[model samples]
Target chain A: MLELLIVSTLNGVLFGMLLFLMASGLTLIFSMMGVLNFAHASFYMLGAFFGFQISRWVGFWPALVVGPVLVGAIGAVVERFGLRNVHRHGHVPELLFTFGLAFVIEEVVQMIWGKSPVDFRVPEVLDFPAFTIFATNYPAYKLFMLLISIGIFVALFAVLTKTRIGLIVQASLTHPNMVAHLGHNVPLVFMLVFGLGSALAAIAGVIAGPALVTQSNMAALLGPILFVVVVVGGLGSLSGAFVASLLIGLLQTFAVSVNVSLADVFAVFGFTPGPDSMLDDLWRVTVAQIAPILPYLLLVLVLILKPSGLMGTRET
Target chain B: MKTTYVRGLAVAAALSLCSAASAQESIKIGYVDPLSGGGASIGEIGLKTFQFIAELQNAKGGVLGKKIEFVPYDNKLNPQESIVQVQKAIDAGIRIITQGNGSGAAAAITEFVAKYNERNPGKEVIYLNYAAVDPVLTNDKCNYWHFRWDANSEIKMEAITSYMKANASIKKVYLINQDYSFGQSVRADAKKMVSAKRPDVQIVGDELHPLMKITDFAPYIAKIKASGADSVITGNWGQDFALLLKAAADAGLQANWYTFYAGGAGGPTAIKQTGLNHRVFQISEGFANIPHAPAQEFEKALRAKYNVGLFYPRAVNQFGMLFAAMEQTKSADPKKIAAALEGMKFNVFSGGEGFMRKDDHQFFQPMYISSFGERGSGEPLDEEGTGWGWKLVGKIDTGSTMVSTTCKMQRPN
Candidate 1:
C-alpha cells in the first residue's frame, strides 16, 4: 500500500507537470487574446515534428533551442495574418479560425511526415536511471522533463509578475486602447504574446515528444484535456491552471490504482444486484476502467458548481 | 419504317457486346482501410502488400486471364466510413472487398456485405478480412460473405497459454490491455486459458486503459512493478503497444511480455530502443526472418521494392488462396469464388498446409511465437532497419491452434 501511494503520487505529479507545460500556453493565450487558441496543440505537434527533423540535422541539444523558435515564429505569423483578421468578426469567427487552422496544420504535417510516428528518442546523456523508489527505476529523461517543466513554470511566473514587458503584455490583455494611447505597440505586443504562448506549447512538445508517442493525432488526443485544465483552473489564471493540472493528473493516476467498484460499495450495504440486472455492467465497472473520463466528469461538475473554475476570477 | 427498326435493333446488339467486353477487362477488388489518417501508416502497408500480391498474380498470366486490380478506398479507420467506402466500391462494380485494421470496421464491413449480397442477388460481394483478430467475428457474429485470414484472439490466447503451460518458470502473470471488446476478450481468455492449463500460476493484475488515448503509461508500469508479475500479456497495438513498452523500459520493469502485435509496423524499432534483448515476444503467422528460403526471398524482394519488410504474411496467403480459388472456379464470379474458398486447404507463405474452416470461414495456420533481439546465426532478416530480429522460439501447428467455434453461418440460396 505504501509503495502504491508513493508511486501514484510521483506519477501523478509528473503527469500534472506535463499537462501544465501544455496548458500554460493555452492559459496565457486565453488571458490575453481570449481566443482559446485551438491550434495551440497543433503548434506543439509542429514543434515535435520540427524537433524530430532538426535533431536529425543537428543534435537534440541544438534542436531543442531551434525547433521552438521556428514554431514560435510560425505562431507569430499566424497571429498577424490569420487570427488577427478573424478577430474583427467577433469571438465565434476567431474560434472557428483557430479550429480550422488545427485541421490545416494536421494535414500539412501529414503531408510532410506521413501518418506514422517519427523516431524521436531521448538523448543518450539523459537515458540512464535517475533514481529508484520501491523497485521502480525512474529514467533520467523523465527527471529532465520534470525539471524543464518546473523551470518553465518558474520562468513564466517571474516574467509575468516581475518584468516590464510582462506588465505591458498584461496591461494589453484588458486595455489595448489605453496601452496604444500610451505609445506602446499594442498590436505587436498581442502578436508577441501569441507567439510566446505557442513557444511555451512548443517547449512542452520538444521535451515530451521523446517520452510520449509523438504521432500525428497527438494533438487531438491531448486537446480536450488541455481545455479541461484551463477551464477547471479558472480561465486566464496561470496558478489556477497549474493547480488544476495536478488535480486532474492525481485524480486519474490514483483512480487507476483503485480497484473498487459500485458492486463492492453496494455489497457493504447488504445489497447485491443479480447478474441479469439492467445495470449489472455498470455495477461491475471498477474505478480504474473509467479513469480516462474522470477529468471530463470533473469539468462538468466544476461548470455546474463553480462556473469560474477552482481558481478563475471570471466565469466563461 | 421496318428498315429503321432493323437498324435500331442492330445498334442495341452492338451495345450489349461492348458491355460484355468491359465486364471481362479486370477483376477489381476494393481495398478499404485507413489510407489517409492516423491508421494510414499500417493501412498503406496493407495496401502495398495486397498490390504486390496482385501484381505477382498478374505477372503469372493473371487470375483466369482477368487482371487483378486493387482499387484503394480510404476508410479513415472508421466503421461508418468503411461502410460508405464499401458502398462506393459496390457502385463501381467491385465484387471483392478487403479490410483488416480494426475489428469494429471488419464487423461493419462484414454485415454490410452480407446485407448487400442478400438484397442484391446477382451482384454479391465477398469481404476478406486480413488482420482483425476479434474472436466474436468468427463465432457469434460470423457471416457467409465474410472470411477471415488471421487467427482470432481466442485462438492466439490458447496458443500462448499452452506454450506458457510447458514453461515452468512463469509463476505470476499480469494482463494489461486496451479497454475495448478486443482487449477485453484477450484478458478474459488469457485468465481462463492460463488458469485451466497451469492452475499453479497466479494472475497478479488485470488492467484496461482507454484505447490509444494514453500518452503516459508510467503509472501502469509502476502498478505492474508493485504486483511482482514475471510475465505480461497485452493485445495493444499501434501507439498503445509502443508507449507501454517504452514506459516499461524507462522504469526498468523486468517482465517477459507476451503480445499479439509486438511485430506490428513500428514495433521492432520500439523494442530495439528498449534494448530488452529477447524479453519481448509476439505471436504471429509469420515474421520477417522466417528461415524458409521462399519466404525469405519474398521478404527480400518486398523490402527491395517498398523499403518495408512484409508485415502481413497472411496477406500473401489471402491473395494466394484468392488466386487459387479463382483458378479452381475458372471464373471471377463472387459466388463461385466463395464456394471454392470454403474448406479450402493451401500451402501458407511461411510454410505448413492450412485450411479455412467451413463452419466460420476462419483460416487456421501454424502460429509462431518469436522474441525480438540481436539476430542468431540462423535468423537472416531483421526488421525496420533494426539489427534485432524475431528469433522463433515456439511454433503451434494448425492442429494445435484450433479452437471450437459456435458459428452458424447463413448460406445464400
Candidate 2:
C-alpha cells in the first residue's frame, strides 16, 4: 500500500509536470490574449506528431529544435490569418474559429500521417532508469522530461521578469492601447507571443510523446485536460494554471492508485454491505476504475469552491 | 396526306427517345475515425484494410464503373469531435457515412441521423457501423439510416457463455466491464446466458472499470481475489485493457486462472504486443490463424506490405464484407446492395462463413479459441509458426456463437 502511494504520487507528479508544460502555454496565451484558446492542446498534439516525423528522419535532438520552430511558424500564420479575421466578429466568433481549426487540423493530420500510432522512442543516449522504487524501474526519459519542464519554467520566468521586451509584452496584456501609443509594435508582439506559446506547447508534446503513447488522437485527449487546468488555475492567470495543472495531474494519478469507496467509508461507520445494491459495485471499487471521472469531479468541485478560479479576477 | 405524314414522323421521334440517364459519379464515402487520437492504432488497421479494398476496386476499375473514395475525418473518438466531422462530411457532399469505435460518438451521430432523416424526407445519409458494439443502435431507438456490421451484445456474449458451459469446468463467474453502453450490453448478455444455461455457476461479483485513463488496478485485483470466482469475464478495450491486464499480472492474476475476458484485448492490440503463438492459453479471432488460401494470401501480402505485427488481419472484416456485397450486387446502388447484403452468406476469402443476417445487417461468423505457449512465466506470447503461443481451439460457429437478429426487424428477401 505504501508502495502504491509513493509510486502513484511520483508518477503522478511526473505526469502532472508534463501536463503543466502544455497548460503553461495555454495559460500564457489566455493571459496575454484575454481570450481562451481552445486549440492550445491541439498545438501540443501537433508538436508530438511533428517531433515524431522529424525524429524519424533527422533524430530526436533535431526534432527538439525543429518541431517547435515549425509549429510556432504555423501558429503565427494561424493567428494572423485565421484568428485575426475571425476577431472582428467578436470573442464568440474567435472562439468558434479556433474550435473549427482544431477539427480541421485533426483531419489534415489524418490525411498526412495515415492514421497510426507513431513510434516516438526516447533517445538512445538518455535511455536508462532514473531510479527504481519497489522493484519497478522509473525510466530516465521521464526524469529528463521533469528537468526540461523546470528548465522551461525558469527560462519563462527569467524572460518575463528580467527582460525589457518581456516587460513591454506583460504590460500590453492589460494596457494594450497605451503600449501601442508608446510605439512598442504591439500587434507584432501579440503575434510573436501567440507563436511562442504554441511553440512551447509543441515542445512539450515532442518530449512527452514517447512516454504518453504517441498516437495522433493524443491531441484531443490533452485538449480538455488542459482546458480544465486553465479553468481551475483561474483563466488568464499563469501561476494559477501552473498550480491547477499539477493539482489535476496529481489528483488523477493518486485517484487511480488507491481504492476508496462510499461502502468502505460506510463500513468504518458501521454500515453493513447490502447484497442487492447499486453501491455493490462501489463496494468492489478501486482507484483505477474511478480515475476517468476524477478530472470531471475536480472540475465541478473547483467551480463550486472557487467560482473565479484559484487566482483569477474574472468569473464566468 | 403530307401533313399526316409529318405528324406521324413527330410521334415516332418522341416514342423513340432514350431514357436519358446520367453518368454515375464517384461515390464519396465519409469515414469518421479516431485516426490520430487514443484510438489511432485501431484507426490505422482499419485504414489499411480500407486502402486494400480501395486499391483492389480501383484496379478492377471501381464499382459500377464509378470510383469509391473514403473521405476520412479524425474525430479522435470523442463524441463532440465526431459531431463536427459528421457535419463536415455532410457539407462535403458525402451521402454515405461509416463510423464506430467510440460508442458515445456513434450515439451522437445516430441521434443526428434521426433528426436529419425527419428534416429531409427525400435524401438520407446512410450510416454503416463497423466496430461500435452498443446494443442501442439496433434497439427500438435505432435510426433508419444506420446499420451495424458487427455482432450485437446478446450474440457476442452468447458466443462466450455457451462455449464456457460446454468446455470449461470453472463453475464460478465474475463480471468486469467498462462503464459504458458496450460494457452494459456485455454484462446484460452475460447475465442472460448464465441464468439460461449454467444456473449452477454462482454469480460472485460484478464490477465496472472506467474507460481510457485507468493506470492502476491493485485494489480491484484484491477485491477480485476475495470474490472467489473460478472464472472472470470482462468486456474492456483500449488503454483500459492494457493497464488492467498488466495490473492483474502484477497482482498475480494468472492467465485463464479466474477470468475469461471476452472482446477487445484478444484483438489487434493483443496480437501486436506478443506473437499469439507463444502463450499458454490464447484467445484470438478466426481470421488470424485459419489456413485458407485467401487468409494465407492476405497474411503474406499484408506482412510483406508493412512492418511485421504492426496490424492484425481482423481489420479486413469491413473490406471483406464490403467486397462480398459489391461482388453480389456489382453496383454501388444502395437499394441493390442492401437487398443483396440482407440474408447474404458471403464467403470472406479469409475463412468462416461470414453471414449478413437479413434482420439488422449484423454479420455473424465463427471465431477461434487458441492455446498459446511461452518460453516460461512472464515471457511474451510466441508468434513463430506453431511455436507461437496460440493454438487452434476449434471454431465457434455463427449459429452457436451468435443468432441472427433479422427476426427483430423484417426486411423482405
Candidate 3:
C-alpha cells in the first residue's frame, strides 16, 4: 500500500507539473486579455512538431530552445495582425477567432506533417531510470519534466512580481484605461503577454511531446483538460490553476490505481445485487473504470456549486 | 455540295461512336474512407494503395477490358459522413464502394448499402471491406451486400491464443483495449480463448480505456506494472496502441505484447523506441517480410512508387478477387459480381489459397503471428524507418481460424 501510494503520488506530481505548464499560460492569458485563447493547445502541438523537425536537423537540445521561440514569434505575429484586428469586435469574436484558428492550425499541421504521430523520442541522456521504488523504475525523463515545470513556475512568478514590465502588465489587467493614460503602450504589453503565454504553451508541448504521443490530434486531446484546469482553478488565478492541476492529476492517478468497485461499496452498505438486476452495470462499475471522467465530474460540480471557481475573482 | 454534306455526316457519326466506346470502357469503384482527421494516417495509405493498384491494373488492360477508375470520397471517419459519401458515390453512377478504416464507419456503410440495395434493386452496389475487423459485421449484423476481406478480430485472437498456449513461459496475462465494439470483441474473445486453451494462465488485469482520448497512459501503465503481468493482449489501434506502448516503454515495464495492430502507422516507431528487442508481436493476414517472390516484387514496386509500405495485403487480395469475379462474370454489374464472389477460392500471392465463405461473406486465409526483431540478411522491408523487421513466429491455417457465423442473409433474386 505504501509503495502504491508513493508511486501514484510521484506520477501525479509529474503529470500535474506538465498540466501546470499548459494551464498556467492559459490562465495568465485569460487574466490579462479576458478572452480564452482556444488555440493554446494547438500552439503546443506546433511546438512539438517544430521541435521534432528541428531535432532531426540540429538535435534535441537546440530544438528545445528554438522550437518555443519560433512558436512565440508566430504567436506575436498573430497578435500583431490577426487577434488585434479581431479585438474590436469584443470577447466573443476573439474566442471564436481562436477557436477557428485551432482548426486551421490543425489542418495546416496535417498538410505539412501528415496525420501520423511523429517519431519524437526522449534524448538518450534522459532515457534511464532516475530511481526505483517498489520494484518499479522511475524514468529520468519524468523527473526532468518535473524540474522544467518547476523552473518555469519560479521564473513566471519572479517576472510577474519583480520586473517593471510585469508591473505594467499586471496594472493593465485591472486598469487598462489607467495604464493607457499613464502613457504606457498598453497594446504592446497585451501583445507581449499573449506571445509569452503562447511561448509557455509551446515549451510545455516541446517537453511533453515525446512523453505523450505527438500527433496532429494532440491539441484536441489535451486542449479540453487545460481548459478544465483553468476553469476549476479559477479563470484568472495562476495559483488556483496550480492547485487545480495537482488536484486533478493526483485525483485521477490515485483513482486509476485503486481497484475498488461499486460492488464493494454495496457490500459495505449490506446490499447484494441479484443476477437479473437492472443495475448490474452500476454494480460492476469500478473507480479505475471511471478515472478518466473524474476531472470532468469535478468541473461540473464546481460550476454548479461555485460559479466563480475556487480562486476566481471574476463573476460568471 | 453533295460531297461536303456526306463528309460532315460521316464525321459526326464517328465522333458519337468514339464517345460511346470510351464510356463503355471505364468501370468506376468508389473509395470511401477518412481522408482527414484522426484516422487519416491509415486511411490515406489505404486510399493511395487502392489508387496505385488501380493504375497498375489499368495499365495491364484493366479488369474485363474496362479501365479501373478509383473515385475517392473523404468520409472523415464519421458514420454519418460515410453514409453521405456513399449516397454521393451512388449519385455519381458508382456501383462498387470500398471502405475500411474504422469498423463503426464500415458498419454504417454496410447497413446503408444493404438497405439502399433493397429499396432500389437495379441500382445496387457492393461494399468491399479491407481493414475493418468487427466480427458482428460478418456474424449477426452481416448483410448480403457487404464482403469483408480482412480476418475478423475473433479469428486473429484465435491464432494469438494458439501461439500463447504453445509458450508455457507466459503465465500471467493482461488485456487492455479501447472501449468500442471492435475493442470489446477483441477483449471478450481474448479472455474466452486464452482461458479455454491455457487454463493455468491467470488474467492479471482487464482494462478498457476511452478510444483516442488518453494523452497520458502512465497511470494505466503503473497499474499494469503493479499487477505483475508478463504479457499483454490489446486490440487498440492508431494512437491508443502507440501511446500505450510508449507509456510501457517510459515506465520500463518488461512484458511481451500480443497486439492486433502494433504495426499500425505510428506503432513501429514507438516499439523501436521502447527497444524491447522482439518482445512485441502482432497477428495479421500478411506482413512486409512474407517470403513470397511475387509479393516482394509487388511490395518493392509499390514502395518505389509511393514511399509507403504495403501495411494491408488484404487490400491487394480484395482487388485481385474483385478483378477475378469481374472476369468470370464478364460484367461490371454488382449482382453478377456478388454471385461470382460467393464461395470463391483463389490462390493468394503469399503462399496459400483463400476462401470466401458464402454464408457470411467473410474471407478466410492463413494468418501469421509475427515478432519485431533485427532484420535478417534476406529481409528487404521494415516499417516507420525502424530497421527492425517483423519476423513470422507462428502460422494458423485458414481452416483452423474459421468460426461458425449466425448470419441470415436476404438475397435479391
Candidate 4:
C-alpha cells in the first residue's frame, strides 16, 4: 500500500509539472489578451515535430533550445499580423480565429509529418532508470522533465515578480491604456508576452515529446485538458493553474489506482441491480473507468459553485 | 406517318444502346474509409492498395468486361460520417462498398448496407471488409450483404494462446488493449483462450485504455512492471500500439509482446528504438517476407508505385476473390457475384488454399506469426527504415484456425 501510494504520488507530481508548464502559458496569454488562444496546444505540437526534426540534424540538446525559439518567433509573427488585425473586431472573432488556426495547424502538420507517430526517443544520456521505488523503475527522462518544469517555474516567478519587465507586464495586464500614456510600447509588449507564452508551451512540448508520443493528434489530446487546468485554476492566475494541475494529476492517478465501482457504492445502500436492468451501465461504472472525466466533472462543479474560480480576482 | 414511326424507333434504339454501353464501361466500387484525420495514414495505404489492384485487373481486360473503378470517400473515422458516405456511394450507382480501418465505422457501414439492401430490393450492395476484426461482426451480427476478409479476433487469440501453451517460458502474462468493442473482444478472447489452453500461466494484469487517446503510457507501463508480467498480449493498433511500445522501450521493460498489429505504422521504428530484436511478435494473414515469387514481385511493384509497404495483404485477397467471382458469374450484378463467392475455395499467395465459409461469409487462410529482428538476406521490405524486418516464426493453417460462427444470415430470394 505504501509503495503504491509513493509511486502514484510521484507519477502525479511528474504529470502535474508537465500540465503546469502548459497551463502557465495559457493563463498568461488569457490574462494579457483577454482572448483564449485555442491554438496554444497546436504550437506545442509544432515544437515537438520541429524538435524531432532538429534533433535529427543537431541532436536533442540543441533542438530543445532552437525548437522553442522558432515556435516563439512564429507566435510573435502571428500575434503581430494575424491576431492584431482580428483584435479590433472583438474577442469572439479572436477566439474563433485561434480555434480555426488550430485546425489549420493540425492539417499542415499532418501534411508534412503524415498522420502517424514519430520515432521521438529519449536521448541516450537520460535513457536509463533514475531510481526504483517499490520495484518500479523511474526513467531519468521523467526526472529531467521534473527538473526542467521546476526551473521554468522558478525563472518565470523571479522574472515576473522581481524584474522591471515583470512589473511592466503586470501593470499592463490591469492598465494597458495607462502604461501606453506613460510612453510604453503597449503593442510591442503584447507581442512579446504572446511570444513568451508560446515559447513556454513550446518548452513543455519539446520536453514532453519523447516521453509522450509525438504524433499529429498530440495537440487535440492535450489541448482540452490544458484548458481545464487554466479554467479550474481560476482563469488568469498562474498560482491557480499550478494548483489545479497538481490537483487534477494526483486525483486522476490515485483514482486509477483505486478499483472501487458504483456497484460497490450501491451495495452499501443495500441495492443490487438485476442482470438485465437498465441501470447496468451506471452500476458498471468504476472510479478508474471515469478517472479521465474527473477533471471536467470538477470544472463543472467549480463553475457552478465558485464562478471566480479558486484563485481569480476577476469575475469569470 | 410510316416515315415518322421509323425515325422514332431508331432514336429509342440508339438511346437504349448508349445507356447500356455507359453502364458496361465501369463497375464502380465505393471505397469508404478514413482518408483524412488520425486514421488517414492506414486509410490512404488501403486506398492505394485497392487502386493498384483495380488497375492491375483493368489491365488484364477488366472484370466481366467492365473496368473496376474505385470511388474514394473520406469518413474521418466517424461512424455517422461513414453512413453518410455510404449513402453518397449508393446514390452514385455503386453496388460494392469496401472499408477497413475502424471497427466502429465498419459496423455502422455493415448495418446500414444490410438495411438499405433489405429496403431497396433491386438496388442491393455488398460490403467487403478487409481489416475490421471484431468477432461479433461475424458471429451474432453477421448480415448477408457483409463479408470480412481478415480473420476475427477470436481466431487470432486462439492461435496465440495455442502458441503460448506450447512455449513453457510464458509463465505470467498481461493483457493490455484499447477500451472499445474490438479491444474488449481481444481481452475477453485472450483471457478465455489462455485459461483454456495454458491454465498454468498466471494473468497478472489486464488493462484497457481509450483508443488513440493516450499520450503517455508511462503510468500504465509502471503498473505492468509492478505486476511482473513475463509477456503481454495486446490488440491495440495505430498510434496506441506505437506509443505503448515506445513507452515500454523508454522504461526498458523486457517482456515479449504478442500483438495483433506490432508491425503497424510507426511500430518498426519503436521496435528498433527499443532494440528488442525478435521479442515483438504480430499475427496477420500475410506479411512481406513470405517466400513466394509472385507475392514478392507484387510487393516490389506496390512499393515502386506507392512508396508504401504491403501492411495488409487481406485487401489484395479481397480484390482477388471479387475478381474471380466476377469472372465466374460473368456479370456485374451483386447478387450473382455474391452467390459465386459463397463456398469459394482458391489458392492464396502464400502457397496455401483459402476458403470462404458460406455459413457466415468469413474468409479463412493461412495466418502467420512474425517476429521483428535484423533483416536477413533476400528480405526486401522493412517498416520505418528500421532495417529490422518481420520474419515469419509460426504458421496456422486455414483448417486449424477455423471457428464455428453463430451467424443467421438472411438471404434475399
Candidate 3 lDDT at B210 equals 78
Candidate 1 stretches with Cα past 4 Å from truth are: B1-25, B36-38
lDDT of 4 by residue, B244-272 (tens): 88777766778999999887777788888
Give each candidate's fraction of reference contacts reproduced: 0.75, 0.30, 0.62, 0.28
Candidate 3 runs further than 4 Å off: A1-4, B1-25, B375-380
lDDT of 1 by residue, A146-244 (tens): 898899899989998899998998899878899999999998998998898888788888888888867788888888999999999999989999999
Error of 3 at B342 (Å): 0.6
- For residues B160-248, what per-residue lDDT tens digits would candidate 1 score against the true structure? 88878888999999999987778889989998999999999999999989866787888898889889999999998866787788888
Pairs in steric clash, model 1 = A234-A312
lDDT of each: 0.88, 0.68, 0.88, 0.87
lDDT by residue (B1-413, candidate 3, tens digit) is 99989999999989989878766768889999877655767777887788899999999999877899889898977889999999999998899999987888888999999899989988889999988899999988999889999999989998899888989899999999887788888989999999999999999999888777787788888888888999999998877787788777777888999999998877887798678888999999888888888888888888899988788888888999999999999888899999999999988757699999999999999888889978887677887788888888888888898998999977778
TM-score chain B for all models: 0.93, 0.77, 0.93, 0.93
Query: What pairs collide in candidate 4?
Result: none
Candidate with best TM-score = 1
Which of 2 and 4 is the better model by DockQ? 4
- lDDT for model 4: 0.87
Per-candidate total of colliding backbone pairs: 1, 22, 0, 0
Scored against the true structure, residue A59 in model 2 reaches a CA lDDT of 97
Residue B222 C-alpha lDDT in model 3? 85
Candidate 2 TM-score for chain A? 0.95
In angstroms, the error of model 3 at A43 is: 2.1
